[model samples]
Target: MIKKLFIIIACILLLSSCSNRVDKGKLNKVGMLVPETINDQVWGTKGYKGLLNIQNDFDVDVYYKEGIENASAIEHAVSEFKQKNVNLIFGHGFEYADTFNKIAKKYPTIHFVSFNGDATQKNTTSLRFEGHAMGFFGGMTAAHMSTTKKIGIIATHSWQPEIKGFVEGAKYEDPNITVLLKYTDNWDDGQKAVGLLDKLLDEEVDVVYPAGDGFNVPVIEKIKEKGLYAIGYVSDQSDLGKNTVLTSTIQQASKLYDIVAKKYAEGTLQSGNLSFDFQDGVIEMGKFSPRVDEKFQRKMKRFVKKYKETGDLPK
Candidate 1:
């Protein structure tokens, strides 16, 4: 067990330390596709941050197309990348996957990555996180801090494995806890998310988390305006309003980008599949903002240790 953990740790160190570029000549172009701009401060921000980090680490030239919504736009974007023989294409959000998979289907030579998704192909891989592992933590934190047992989750989509993972995670932590969960079916609509937040607030949910891509700005604002607590998502967003945010679930974009770009450069890139669960450190909790209680801190520690030691959540 120690050996396995040490190896995982070693891989992490190596991946983090890797920065040698084999002269990222203009040989192959890379495209980083986003459903929204980095201005959103959530998923798109993390993805865009990943793109810049990769470019900084390696000498590769990156082409980015941001604010792509809808299947047609995504399809067109992928098609554009393939026509340019882009080395690797990174698509953010599950909504972009079907379109990417369709475009990647005909282009076997190009490599593709779908972030926050679990779809696959020979040249395309789906990379997802076990947010369920942390969702329990989020829930417990919310439960502890919430004046009402009512906590809320505003997700980007209605239902999916990732969302289900959060549901299972939260319920596993407290079966009797009341959670008000909803989805906007869109990632860019802060107005919609704000409206949802208002509704959840009407339900008396004090602790909330917005799991939409970059739409967290408004959510955090609402949390602050109402003098409530919230858990941030995608990146380490506690800094947005440190007083209002407890902690956050960060999808390590640069870390994933490092591994993918390294493997692709090494010609040993794993094809057809890719994923990073919480156990893999792909999903991590941000530093807790100041003033979090010892009780909630202990809960997070216990849950993390339980998962790490037993490879399962505590029931």
Candidate 2:
């Protein structure tokens, strides 16, 4: 009777251990929350593409909610995902960082990922793009192509490091170049960005960098109408106008998503705010327009190659 009791106890313990173990292969369900419509053809679209990449690579059940900006909306989306037993959740912008951290505590087994913000919880991570170098390169391109020696940047906010990099890069190319800066204070305000562009044009700014993804395409169109040069942001905009848009600073969002999913599947993804730069192939310069001279293009190529090899930008 004692031997029979011991066997029953050992078998129960073995079953409990098996149940507690996480099957890494079964980490298939993924959820994503975006701040705006995926039809924006820039940031929002890129985010959706990232989710698609994860789905294609991992063969996971992926779900997404658009216009999930507010905390209440976020909570609702997360709750729904929880019901589906989502193993991973992606918050596509920095705005989701704080809310995700708070929500993570409730869903301890689920990992949360966001972009460009601080992550505090063990189950959360913020992927920050080191875009300063690319911004610098964009500034250099603007400076090289600007006939007026006066360039302008219309950005969503003043806190973006790319703004500082743009200034420094333009000055690096031409010390006497004038860089005018304006802020829209909101990302999706195209009319406001155009109004700012007009203000810069009035100041005789011939080159413009519309740094917000929400308004870049329209701003580039305006720049084309004015026959002025522009530096595209987030994605390649050379297709907007071959002569008008000089080059673009690209963030390879799809690739980043694949990498993140792979790491998570391997159980090697670390928590915290992680940073990626040009070396990681996450940040890159898009195709240059025919407007950029060959001599300058070669120089730009050399700069990029050196930067990638040494992780140093031109001083």
- Tell me the whole-model lDDT of each prediction, alpha carbons only: 0.74, 0.90
lDDT of 1 by residue, 153-177 (tens): 8988765344555556556656766
Error of 2 at 269 (Å): 1.1
Candidate 2: tens digits of C-alpha lDDT, residues 149-177: 99999999888878999999999999999
Candidate 2 has an lDDT of 0.90
TM-score of 2: 0.91
Error of 2 at 34 (Å): 0.6
Best by lDDT: 2
Could you tell me every candidate's TM-score relative to the true structure? 0.82, 0.91
Which window of 10 residues has the lowest lDDT sum in candidate 1? 19-28
Worst 10 residues of 2 by lDDT: 17-26
